[model samples]
Target: MAYPIVITPEKNNEHYQYLVFLPDFGAYCQANSIIEALRVAVKFIRDYALINELPPMKLKLPHSTGEQLVTFVNVNLAAKKGK
Candidate 1:
């Protein structure tokens, strides 16, 4: 089951770290760096699924909000990342 993992950096401190939330496992992690946090989150989710013997659940991608929010880069540069 593919799930959505939302990784949002804290607004007050950008470089401090990232806050990762895995809703499927109801688990969260705060790491000194983004990469480390992501790695832990994935490992936790995998272990949880295996131990619980829960079948994979299909995840529906969320839709973007209609509101136009301000972003750091222009659309062209953002598009290059394939959003």
Candidate 2:
């Protein structure tokens, strides 16, 4: 099953950075930087879903309004490493 995933980056005080992930079923994760953040985020989602016996997520990025929200659809997890 393919599920949508949204990524949003926010900077607090120009020092602290956080990325928010809005996956399917309201599954969300936050971290710093796209690379490190996603690494942990994916693991978190996987573990969380497995714990709940949920299906695999396809990973999608839906468009969102408001500032600090970076949305992308069908983004390859590997591609995030470069950013």
Instruction: Give the whole-model CA lDDT for all candidates, comma-separated.
Output: 0.52, 0.54
lDDT of 1: 0.52
**Candidate 2 overall lDDT versus native:** 0.54
Q: Which stretches of candidate 2 lie over 4 Å from their true place?
A: 1-3, 13-16, 55-60, 66-83
CA shift of 42, model 1, Å: 1.1
Which pairs clash inside model 2? 3-58, 5-60, 61-72
lDDT of 2 by residue, 1-83 (tens): 33445555565536436656655656666666766655555565555555585555545556676655554323343443454
lDDT score at residue 14, model 1, on the 0-100 scale: 57
Model 1 segments more than 4 A misplaced: 11-16, 62-83
Q: What is the lDDT of residue 10 in candidate 1?
A: 59
| lDDT top scorer | 2
